[model samples]
Target: GFVYAVTTADLYIRGGLANRVLVIGSETFSRILDWSDRSTCVLFGDGAGAMVLEAGEGAGSIADHGVLAASLRSDGAHKDKLFVDGGPSTTGTVGHLRMEGREVFKHAVGMITDVIEATFSAAGITAEDLDWFVPHQANKRIIDASAKKLGIAEQKVVVTVDLHGNTSAASVPLALSVAVADGRIKKGDLVLIEAMGGGFTWGAVLVRW
Candidate 1:
């Protein structure tokens, strides 16, 4: 699945879904930053990375399968509040990401949590049974709150926002690669990946790697 701003002039694009979704949360804020504007620039960076997840055999529950469950959600009402101003017809130009940070923050927390819980229920797993919880690397505050609400330890979560900022579609897989390469994620371990983007689009992928 892909996450982008449909409310803005930017055209959305996505590719076919393969057998597996490694899941990631990468950002490239620096590449799109107005460096002079510290409020936004200071919150970004640029990079790309990816993860690898193959099909596995399991009984039925999350404990039985590679990716036993996941959830997706959206809300169109707040579209304009956190989107770019220009589009092909309006200004014949692509506008930068304009957001009411705090506003987006509120929706993000609730949505992320909602998806996570749904994923667990669908998979027949409990939050306590999760080995890792990975969320979009949007902000530290949102990350911390989601973890707390889910009763997950802060150390069990993966974060790349400070370095990658908000690489959009690239974030999740990139962080997964980091964890695996660093020996943090191991084979047969359970990982829950979730994200919320401008479309108000969000989803969760629970997998075993």
Candidate 2:
């Protein structure tokens, strides 16, 4: 979700459609959750995030201080593994969130690494070249496993799930904000933002900030 926003903003900025774009991702999972269902309800949190992307001039190289590359993918075959049970048109109700937690974790790691690798390849760099990796704050096991598989060091990964349970669409931007506010992410640093969510959606966006 965050990757899609960033990439879309990049397109508008580069295409001369807009000088700046305010991309915001806000979610209120608590409202849609069934509080009685501890399994899925407790795993979510309410949060919102906003980012402003403006036009910038660069040398047209990998060193550009903006969105460099992005890779997005979605597979509905596994949609039932992670999704809400109701919707307005389908069920005439906003249903509770439902998921097969174990099944999601199994696919999350593989799907995440696949798209991230594609982004890295498109930008002609590897995990070692990234200054920081801010991934979806969904699960610690999945986050750690994905990084380990991609060869990204532990210290370079920005984590906040321990602090903020999963914020859905707000995960990446929230983590990015935390890292930035703490002085971890800084100017000219190569950062990679990745996320996986309901609908079996996943994506990776590389930026030089």
Candidate 3:
């Protein structure tokens, strides 16, 4: 959802549909979780994060303010790998989250890094050019694997999973906020953001901060 939010805002700005857009990613996984299920219950927490994007004039280079490039992708084939067991229309009740953790982890790093590379290609930049890589706060292992695969330095990745748990949609933005607040991300910095979610949905966004 964080990737979806940022991509949608970027598209709107590029399409002349809007000048400034507010994108938010929030989730309350606790409400739907089966507390008895430790696997899913203990891994998530409720949280929200937001950002406002405004139009800016640039020289059509990588130095452009706001979003420079983005890539969004989804695969329904892996939908059952991580999902809830019930839905309002299907089961008439909100259901507990269920997941095949090992299976999802196996595909996550590759899926995430693929989109990040695509975004870098689209922006005419590389991981070496990034000042920060803020990925979804799903877990330390996934975050570490993705960064390592992309060759993005450990110092460049913004991680907040330890402090916030897996806030689902809120992960990226929350991590970004932390990086920015602590001075790791700053003016003119090139930042890369990415996420992979339950529907097997995933995407990446490149921005000049």
Candidate 4:
């Protein structure tokens, strides 16, 4: 949702459909999590985050104060790897979240880094050019692995999982908010955001603050 929100807003602005958009990502994971299932429940929390994007002028370069490039992708074949067990259409009930943690971790880094690379390529920049890498707060392992694989410096990664847990779609924006509030992200800085969610949906967005 966070990826889609930002991408959609960027498209609208570029397409001359709108000058500004309020993109929000929120989740109530606690409501659907099985409290007894420590593996899933204990790894998640409830949260919300938002970003307001408006058209702005730049020097017609990567330093533009708006979204520069984005890449969104999904694979249904891997959907069962991480998902809720029930839904209204299937069981007439909101289901508890279920996941194969090991399987998810195995593929997460590759999937996330792939889109991020594509985004960087589209923006004509590399990991070294990024001021911050705000990835989904899924876990330390995934975040570390992805950053390491991309060669992004440890100091440039914005992590908030330890402070807020995995808030699903809300992770990226929450981390962004935290980083901005703490002065880690600043005006004119190049920021890269990425996330992989249920249904095997994932994406990346590159922006200049």
Clashes of each: 14, 1, 0, 0
Q: Write the per-residue lDDT of candidate 4 for residues 108-147, one digit (tens) a residue.
A: 9999999999998988999999999999999999999999
The lDDT of each candidate is 0.67, 0.91, 0.89, 0.90
RMSD of 2: 1.9
Ranked candidates (lDDT, high to low): 2, 4, 3, 1
TM-score, structure 3 vs. true:
0.95
> Is candidate 2 or 4 superior in TM-score?
2
Which order, best to worst by TM-score?
Answer: 2, 3, 4, 1
**Ten consecutive residues with minimal summed lDDT in candidate 3?**
85-94
Model 4 lowest lDDT segment of ten: 85-94
List the lowest-lDDT window of 10 residues for candidate 2: 86-95
- Considering every candidate listed, which one attains the maximal lDDT? 2
Q: What does candidate 3's lDDT look like per residue over 68-127, in tens digits?
A: 899999999998999987665455355778888999999999999899999989988878
Determine which window of 10 residues in candidate 1 has minimal summed lDDT: 5-14
- All candidates: TM-score: 0.79, 0.95, 0.95, 0.95
Per-residue alpha-carbon lDDT of model 2 for 1-209, expressed as tens digits? 88888998999889999998999878888778878778888889999888888888899899898899999999999989989876644543567788899999888899999999999999999999999999999999999999999999999999999887999899888999999999999999999999888898889999999
The alpha-carbon deviation from the true structure for residue 12 of candidate 3, after best TM-score superposition, in angstroms, is 1.1
- Compared with the true structure, the alpha-carbon lDDT of candidate 1 equals 0.67
Off by over 4 Å in 4: 88-94
lDDT, candidate 1, at 36: 60
